[model samples]
Target: MSKMYLELAKRNLQRAKVRSLLAVIGILIGVMAVSAIGIFGESLKAAVLQNFEDVANELIVSPNFQEGYKYLDEKDISRIKKLPNVAEAIPIKSDSLLVESKKKKSYAVVYAMDEKDVEDMFKAEKGSIRLKSSCVVGKRLAEFADIRVNSKITIAGREFRVAAILEDTGARFDINPNSAIILSPEDFEKVSDVGYTMLIVKAESLEKVDDVKKEIEEKINSRDEKVVVFDLKIILERINEAFSQINTFLMAIASVSLLVAGVSILNIMLMSTIERTKEIGIMRAIGAYRSTILRIFLMEALILGLIGSAIGSVLSIAGGYAIDLMILQDASYVFRLSTLLYISLGFSIGVMVSVLSGLYPAWKASRLEPIEALRYE
Candidate 1:
């Protein structure tokens, strides 16, 4: 009986082929808009997150210059190492110094850290990190100064060999080594007597970053707020939250298209009811129940929704890929599970809106008086 009604509904839709096609196209556009926008947002978020993965579990502790503290001391490092969840607390001394390489002079930001800390914190692109009486050059510095491994450079009139060339690490809050130089503590003292400038604390795990940061703040800044601890996890959370709000805003804008599609379906269903009124009256006169008339009209709506949504789902894949590539320069995130869920969400919404739009029309048709409809021209 249900199959017979669906067949009849299909036949009824064929009566106004152009109108049905328009309704289907409306739904297709709506679904495509919602799914594609969602996928694009997800891909953009993924791309942004890749840059922070390396530093997420690290914390930067810098002296509060507002409190008159010029630099971090050995006491601060000792206090931080005793804190819970801290894996390693490495002190760093930084200053700008004149460097001469191949007679081309330029000022570069110089860092002084323990040899072991340098090995752990940075990766060598070409040579090994051996900071004895040697220094490691950043990728940009190496290229600008025309220096390579074992090349001698003068730092404040003191000569030192380039031990390694560090890989380019993009912009970072803790340290940007891409345009700087790193040297051992002994070499730094010979050039300048400045103390440690900051400390980079590595947490035992990603989940413990907050705990480590909190402990450091409570202990180090308990009295006078002498130092500030920067939690990268908090920064990451704020970034994720920002992206989430953006995604929601985009999805809301896209949803307006679906609502417009729903309105189109409603208009189409209403028109269908008006055209079939006489036929409906004849069916009523032939002992057809009101519920039967409602079912037939509803089945028409269901069929249209299924066809439109199915096509939209298939097309959304291409749409998502295009959006990802255009916006993020990467299409890999489009295939993620989160992105696919957006497509399913769009398809479900299309079907639900179509059936709901048909409700009032089906009800009106079912409620028409058999005798009055039959007498109408």
Candidate 2:
């Protein structure tokens, strides 16, 4: 009986070769788009999360500011260091500046800190910072600036010798490797004369985040008059809220395509059943069960779905590769196992939808009167 069903499905598929091919192609394209999107989104999230973790262990502390920009003074850093469960706290007087060299120049966001902190931020590729009058440049900056080792560079109206060039790590930053320069906060002070602007705190563990944050807030508020530590969870929630909107938009668009596909499946299956009425009638006459007829049509539709979705998955992978090359050529971004799970889930759902779509047509096919079907054909 299964063999008979397969034979009928193959014949039916062959009868409308172009239509079947096109339907499968449509489904394949849709599935592939979804798969590629899943890979890209997951990879992006992981990269950003790693970047955040690199800044500190779990939580970060910055002054509560209305403009989303502010720095913790040196005194504030000293106090946060005293908090329990603290690991290592680093202070950076960071700001952006347009840097120029004899070769070329681009605007750079520069972080000013002690030489030790600056050294840890990047590996020197060309030369070493002399600590007194030399500056470290990012790899991209060195090539873009067209500067060689021991070259002179100027930033924020100050001159410094090029101590070292950093390896390109594809990270956006204010110098160690990217378009950034790391100098002593004291030296940065003489150039810009701006007050301390940022402090990066590294906590010991996840469990201590809230406790450390609360301690710092209470301690700072008690000592100062109006300063307050704004809640960080609120910020994360807001970011999630934005992503939710994006998720909704993508789902809605996918739904439109799915609905069209559903309608197409229903129409095609119903027509096939109408044409195969005599075959169904012959089976019924031979004592074949109605359930068997239904199964045949459902299986046919399921096969079509699987074929289409497989095509889509292939398309998606190719598209994903192209996008990865454009955006993160050097970065490691691959389809996650979860993406395969998602594809499996998608494939299963398509098969189920195809089966469901043929239900009425299949039932009608099974219920046809053998005498009437034979007389008409």
The candidate maximizing lDDT is 1
For model 2 the local lDDT of residue 246 reads 61
Stretches of model 1 off by over 4 angstroms after superposition: 1-5, 286-291
lDDT of 2 by residue, 273-326 (tens): 878888777888888787888777777787778887776666666766676667
Write the residue-wise lDDT of candidate 1 on 183-262 in tens digits.
88988999988988889999999999988988998898888888988888888899899998999899889988878888
For every model shown, what is its TM-score relative to the native structure?
0.90, 0.70
Report the number of the highest-TM-score candidate: 1
CA shift of 9, model 1, Å: 2.8
Write down the RMSD of all candidates, one decimal each.
Answer: 2.5, 5.3
In model 1, what are the clashing residue pairs, if there are any? none
Q: Let me know the TM-score candidate 1 reaches against the reference structure.
A: 0.90
Task: Report the Cα lDDT for residue 258, model 1.
Answer: 79
**Overall lDDT per candidate, in order of appearance:** 0.90, 0.67
